[model samples]
Target: MKHDDYDNLNEGTRSRIRAKRRKTNLILNSLIVVVILLIGIVSFNIFFSNDEGAADQNGVVAEKDQDAASRDKKEDSKDAGKKEDSQESGKKEADESESEEEADEESAEEEELSDPIVTEGGSDANVKQTIENPEWKPVGTTQSGEHTTVFDQNAVDWQEMILAYSYATGIDKDNMTVWFNGNGGAPNTAVGTISEKGSDQTFRVWIEWVDGEGWKPVKVEELIQNDQKQS
Candidate 1:
């Protein structure tokens, strides 16, 4: 029966004990709050650091990939430019070749144009060079060799004979005269009858006076103004 007298303490002592307990409880609560706030701040910092590192890594990878794509595009552009340049050079060479071919064709055309045209000699006027008269042939000559006797049996060929004689000697036969009588005029002789080609017999002669020359009792072949000069 030795009981403690704690319940019988005075009011002031009891009040002092209660105040001590309350003060201890308040200090413990404030310490717990400060610990909890520090933990939250540390966790948030860890999460932000990790997220920032991952984002920076992704950004670096993206930049590298973009650089690679840019390089590839540049190479492709260079290749395209080279292809265009080659095509342009080839086109120029082809154009030059075509121009040369055209020039050659034009030169050939000009050469063809410069040629001369010729025709056949079917209607040539140089077919016959002699007359169709037999009286142009000399039958005899005088003893003095001054006169030649030209005779034709057919007097119808007298015109051709005169033309032939004029052509042969370059003389004007129109100035000459002929007579059948021996006593008709000067320089008339009694020559024999002319019998040629079984034609009609006739006695005819001529006399002509040529300039710069003596009187010609026979045929004078050509004149100065004619193209029948003796070669």
Candidate 2:
């Protein structure tokens, strides 16, 4: 072949080869860029999804805690209410007990006033007559009108002497009085007697005086004081 024709053929082949290499390089660069984009998208989706799931879990836990707290508060309120009710019930019971005690005291006083067993005489009739008779003067005071007087053998019956003695000594039948008539020559001297009437015309009597809070019966052997010297 001629020299010029050969040179032209070589130049055409070099140009075609350079164009093919440029196309192959461009295709490879495009594939690498697409791979990097896909990786970035997948990473971003994974991170956001994990964050959302964590938030959901936290919200659920918080809600559960609130519910538990509310339940506990309700239970505590109920307990407080129950305690208040119990206290009220206890107060009511105490009040009732106090009222019952007062009633019992009143009843005891009434019983003491009404139940008449016996007094300083052999029978109820004798005591009643002695108290009723204005002439049945007690020994101690000149003024009559239920005043106390000593027992005088001449002034009163021997069996009903305690009635006269009680009047003279100012001793109440319900309450005991002290015996100041033990010494000689004292005025209006004689301890009182308590008596009760039994069936079949029989009678029981006790001569007693006050010592502290108790009533002590006097013995028959005890002597009667005489006020003649004082008079």
Expressed as tens digits, the lDDT of each residue in 100-210 for candidate 1 is 999999898766534423222211232112112222333222134344333453442334344433333334556433322122133322221112223232223233323
lDDT of 1 at 104: 99
- Name every residue pair that clashes in candidate 1: 169-221, 169-222, 170-221, 170-222, 170-223, 171-221, 171-222, 171-223
Candidate 2 local lDDT, residue 101: 100
Cα error, candidate 2, residue 194 (Å): 34
Mind giving the per-residue lDDT tens digits that candidate 2 earns over 52-96? 999999999999999999999999999999999999999999999
The whole-model C-alpha lDDT of candidate 1 against the native structure comes to 0.47
- TM-score of each prediction: 0.42, 0.44
